[model samples]
Target: MGFFPDLPITTERLTLRPFTRGDVDAVLDYRGREDVALYLFDAPLSREECALAVQQRILQTSWSEEGDKIVLAAVLSESDTLIGELSLIWRSEDARQGEIGWIFHPDHHGRGYATEAAGALFDLGFQGADLHRIFARCDARNGSSWRLMERLGMRREAHFREHALFKGGWDEEFVYAVLRREWRNGG
Candidate 1:
């Protein structure tokens, strides 16, 4: 993979940027909610935990080698509100593949924020980072996430049944992906 670009990728309505110390409160406000933590791997975090998480995210702003993960805070341009978070994980150096994921506050749902932010991450992964392929995975039950993946022009590549046990039950997973060529051709 190539070098990661600088911070703060601006969309028409959102800013994709590094997490800051000041964002800790907002992070806890959203991430601490039970509804928001339902599908997440980790349980709802407390203020102290969120502060540490934000600190770690701040440190990740400096792009490192392949396999390093970059986490960006999705903020509303007008209000500068931290609405969500997006991540790109360099999956493989030789294969030039990466994985992307996101989490948004429930209050901001039904809007196009996740779609817009994720699309920008895809563009950065393929065009800026020079990755050959980028993919995303979500719990099959999470209709909104998979739908957003489809809206971003990624094709459904795989579906694993009862993939894992989560939240005291079985969970399926769907994999969606797009290749550099496919992205370039506007697929």
Candidate 2:
């Protein structure tokens, strides 16, 4: 249950860490790629732009209290290379629930990194942060990420049509949830 508060979070082959000023280059390198930002809320960002965004996020997470948000950078444990990012946001006024999401470099896709990091964040959000539930919503067209949600034992609770506008017109999406009572890990 021990986590690297601001340094890094380690998995067998990955390390979930916090953002650093030095991370500007990596953030710029990957974030600027169209494929990486395709599903994200924003368009491709330059390194300078992402650095500002990263700093803002860092400030928010660093100053958060018990019932606030948590964002982690997924890095390669061995080399500590930042590969992706994950987040847990407590949207409930009482901080009883959270919403989780992630974005990984396309080069790092299909390696199970997103799912592994997501599960770890879920554990932290619930067991560590004492949240009652953690859920995620994404465009239905994002089948890969949605599949990861299912793999993490979340159940699809809702599907909204034309709920958002992406690169073009409207988009439909699904919501998935997992309650604290329903979470289980392999022994």
The deviation in Å at residue 56 for candidate 2 is 1.4
- Model 2 agreement with the true structure over 63-151: per-residue lDDT tens digits: 15444556778888877788888888766736477789888888888888898899888777666766688889988888888999999
Model 1, C-alpha of 65: deviation from truth (Å): 3.2
**lDDT of every model, 2 decimals:** 0.89, 0.78
What is the Cα-based lDDT of residue 147 in candidate 1? 96
Q: Which stretches of candidate 2 lie over 4 Å from their true place?
A: 1-7, 62-68, 93-95, 185-187
In model 1, pairs of residues that clash are none
TM-score of each: 0.94, 0.88
Tens digits of per-residue lDDT, candidate 1, 110-182, equal: 9899998998998888778888999999989899899999888899999999978999999899999999989
The candidate that achieves the highest lDDT relative to the unseen native structure = 1
